[model samples]
Target: MSLRFADGDFQSAWKELDEPQLDGGWELFTETMGVQIHRLYDEETGLYEYKVFGVLAACTPELCADVYMDLAYRKQWDGYVKELHEKDFDGQKAIYWEVKYPFPLSNRDYVYMRERQDLDMDGRKIWVILAKSSTVTPCMEKSGVLRVKDYKQSVALESDGGCGTKVFMNYFDNPGGMIPPWLVNWAAKSGVPGFLTDMQKACKGYANYCQKK
Candidate 1:
C-alpha cells in the first residue's frame, strides 16, 4: 500500500469527524450490551449510516483509544475482520482489511488510510481515530473479495467521570453489491454493539497484558 499524508492531516480529518451530520436525521435503533445505537437514511447515497454511544467502566479514554488505534492489538478483539495488517507506512499509514461476511455475499475488503489525533476540550481530553477507504498504488484487490471503497469509520473516546471511558462511533459504508435491506439493518444494529462490547473486554485484557510486560 502507498499513502501520502502531511503534517496535521490526521488532525484536520479528526476535527472534521467531530461532526457526523446526524443533527435531526438520526432515529433510535436499539440499546444492547450497554450501547445505544441509531441510524438515519441518506437519500442521496441510498444507504443508512449508523451511530452508537456507550460508556465502559474501569477504562480510561487513552486506553480505549490505544486499543482502537493499534492494529497489532486488533486481532485480539475484532471478530468480523478476517485479515488486517499494514501494507505500508511512513507518516501515512495504509492498510488492507478483509471483512468476513455471513455468506453467500462475497466477503469484502478495503484499503484505507488510518488517522489518529488527540484534542483537549475544556479541561478534558478527547481521542479520535478515523479510517477511510483509499487508493493505495501498491495494493490490488484480491480475486475473491469485493472491493469496498465507500467506507468511513470514526471512533471518539473521552473520559466520563473518573474511571470510565465514553465512546461515540459512526460507520457508513456501501458493500458494493446488492443486499437486502433487512440484512443491512440487522448488521447495523448488531455490529456496533459487538464492537464496543469487544472493546470493553479488550481493555480489561490489555491491562493484564501490560502488567505482564
Candidate 2:
C-alpha cells in the first residue's frame, strides 16, 4: 500500500518512542533476549500501555520496516494470526485482523488504518509505522469474536549504529468484556516477548522470502 503518512507524523512518533520513560508509573514487565518491556497502567481504561525497546541484530532499519509492512509475509511468520488482509474503503485503506486465542476464550479482531514512513534525520535514517482503530464500510463485526475498538500501536526503527536496527514500540488496546487478570498478565509478560522473538526471526528470513518473488 502507498504511504499516507506525513513527514511530521514520523518525526513526532519517533521523538516520543525513541526514549524509554523509566520514571513515572512505568515498571519493568519482562526482559528476554535483550529486549525490555515496560508497562504503565491507564486509570481511564483500566488497561496497561506497553513500551518495548530492543534491537534486531544484523538487520537494517529499511529491511525491518519492509518486514513489518509486508502482510503477505506476515502470515507466513506470525502463527497467532487467524485472518489478516487489507481492505480499501473508497479511497482509504485499512486492515482487518483476527487473532487466535486460547481455547474456551472467544477470538479477538481489529480493524484499523495504518501507515508507515521512512525519514532521514540529517544523516541518520528512521522508520515509523502507526496504527489506530477505525470504522470502515463493509468491514462488519464478526459473530462470536470480540472487536477491539480502542487500539493504537506505534513503532520506531533506526540504525543501531551498525548493521542492526534499534526497535521501539508503544501499544495499548481494550479487547472489550471482562478478562481475567492472570490472562492479561500472561499476555503482557510472556506474549509481548514471544511476539518480539518471533519478529526477529521473521526479519532474518525476510530477505530470502523476497528473493523467490
TM-scores of the models, in the order given: 0.83, 0.91
* Model 1: per-residue Cα lDDT over 1-213, one tens digit each: 344445454444334335544567798889887777778888977988887777787889899888877676787678778998887544455788898988788899988887777877566588877777886434777887899888887777778778988777777888888888788878877766666778888988987766775
Q: Best by TM-score, which number?
A: 2
Q: In model 1, where do residues sit more than 4 Å from their true spots?
A: 1-21, 89-92, 136-138, 210-213
Cα lDDT for residue 189, candidate 2: 82
**In angstroms, how far off is 184's CA in candidate 1?**
1.3
- How far is 123's C-alpha from truth in model 1 (Å)? 2.0
Candidate 2 off by > 4 Å: 1-9, 16-18, 136-138
Per-residue lDDT of candidate 2, residues 1-213 (tens digit): 343556666676777545565678999888888888899999998889998888888878898889889999999999989999998867778898999888888899998889887777787778999988886544778999999988888899998889888888889999887888999999988888788778888989988999987
